[model samples]
Target: MRAVRYHEGGDPDVLDLEDIERPDPGRGDVLVEIEAASVNPVDAKFRAAGLPRLPKTTGSDLAGTVVAVGEGVDDYAEGDRVFATGLHTGRFAGGSFAEYAAVPTDLLAHLPEGVSFEHGAAVALVGVTAWRALVHHAGLEPGGTALVHGGNGGVGHVAVGLADALGATPVATARPQYHDALGDLGAGTVLDYGRDDLADAARDATGGADAVLDHMPDTYLGTDVAAAGFGGDIVAIAGDTATFPDVAAARSAELDVHMMSMSNLATHSDAPDIGPILDRIGNLLAEGRLDVTIDRTYGLDEAAEAHRAVLEESFLGKLVVEP
Candidate 1:
């Protein structure tokens, strides 16, 4: 099988295409013939930050067909179209950059009837992240307001779609060029992060949001704290640390501040399981209630180029590779 592997971490150039033996399915695992895989920040992070093990196949989300299933797996069988997470080594090990991947059953979900392979693969990682943030953590309410920062980002895009699908009013922050696209995706109002009064614009739109989804907490925590309504909740899905403008802002608003990492769900044993939410998203995609835009596609051998594109430029949506 041809897979993109990095022997050592440095730059995007470290990714190389090499023929490796296919992985075998273990107990409760399924061997999938990967049709598509998506490049996420974590895939690039594995390379830039360095890993303890060399020859790491970096990718955690994939859409493919089941070739075979290992013992104790009866819910899925040969020829089942599926998408899964945890590809390489983590809570799940989802190395979907290869032509074939052995995915744990818990992390797998059926690809709904109308969803394409590229979208199915692209949606798993970002969709699950948004799902955990909005549904599990934030409890975004119907007809209530949702303030979404970085609405054009991978997870932010999905968050916009999910917020709309849940019947909530969504106000998003993005560049001027992204306003139309995000509006079409259900963001009630779009504010330019660079030019607009983020806090005031968000406050006026639906009179402040019940929940704020801040993807860039390091820079936007103050904005989130300011935009949130009384008793509102704020969840930061990205960044390791945050600095607030003052304790008074959060204290006066009575905000429920939280830091969320999608990786945490996979790493911790007691974190809420995302398997069922994955299925819920799949159904929404099938019903035409959810959609993701693919910005680009590359093959296994062209992964280096894809990595450079993802890390260097600002693209509108997810990027995928077919192996």
Candidate 2:
């Protein structure tokens, strides 16, 4: 099997395409022949910082077909087409960036009838993160207002669509060029993030955003704190470092701020069964209610190039690497 792995993490250049023996599924696992894998920002971060295993396959999202099943696996069988996040029970078994992977059945999700491999891969990680942030942390409900920083962005775009699907009106910020895209996804109004007074603009757009999904925590954590309506929720879905929030504003508004990590759900033993949520997301994709944007595609051999592109380019959506 041909896979992209890094002996020691440093940068995009660290990722190399190599020939390795294919892995067999262990107990309660499924060996999926990779069709497409999606790269998220975390993949780059993990690549640069080193991983739990040396020479690790770093992709976390995949859309593929089950070619073999290990013991205790019955939900799926040979040739069952599926898409899944490989980080289950917080353990890393080579990510999806390869020709094949042994994924636990608990992490598997059925790909809907009409969704393509690329779209399925694109939605894997970001989709679940957005679903957890809006549906759980934000406690967002229809007829409410959602303020999404970077609304047309990777996770932000999904937040917009899911919030709308959940019946809330989402207001997101984006570069002027992406305003229409956000608007099309049911953003009440897409603010120009270039301006500094976003809190004020968001206020005017919907009187005040009821909930905030902060994608750009470095830039918008304080802003989200300031804009959230009294007693509103603000969920931070990204950011690796500790962020300082406006204590005064938070105290004044009595805002409920929380941090969301999909990784915890993927790895934590106490995490809820994601299969149900994933199934719901699949249904939405099948029904065209949930939206996904596949911004770019690369071949397995071009994995290094794909990593570089993710870092250098301002992609409109998810990036997929096919094997």
Best by TM-score: 1
Residue 180's lDDT within candidate 1 is: 97
Model 2: which ten-residue window has the lowest total lDDT?
85-94
TM-score of each: 0.96, 0.95
Worst 10 residues of 1 by lDDT: 85-94
Off by over 4 Å in 2: 86-89, 240-243
Clashes of 1: 8
For every candidate, C-alpha RMSD to the true structure in Å: 1.4, 1.6
| lDDT string, candidate 2, 267-316, tens digits | 67887656677788888889998888887789988888887777677757
**Cα lDDT of model 1 by residue, 1-323, tens digit:** 88888888889889888899988889988899999999888788887766636778878789999999999999999999999775645645547789998888878799987799999999998999888888777888788888888888888888999999999988988888999999999999999898657777778885867888987888888888778888888988877677777689789888898788777766677886557778999999999998898988998988888777777777777999999
Native-vs-model 2 lDDT?
Answer: 0.82
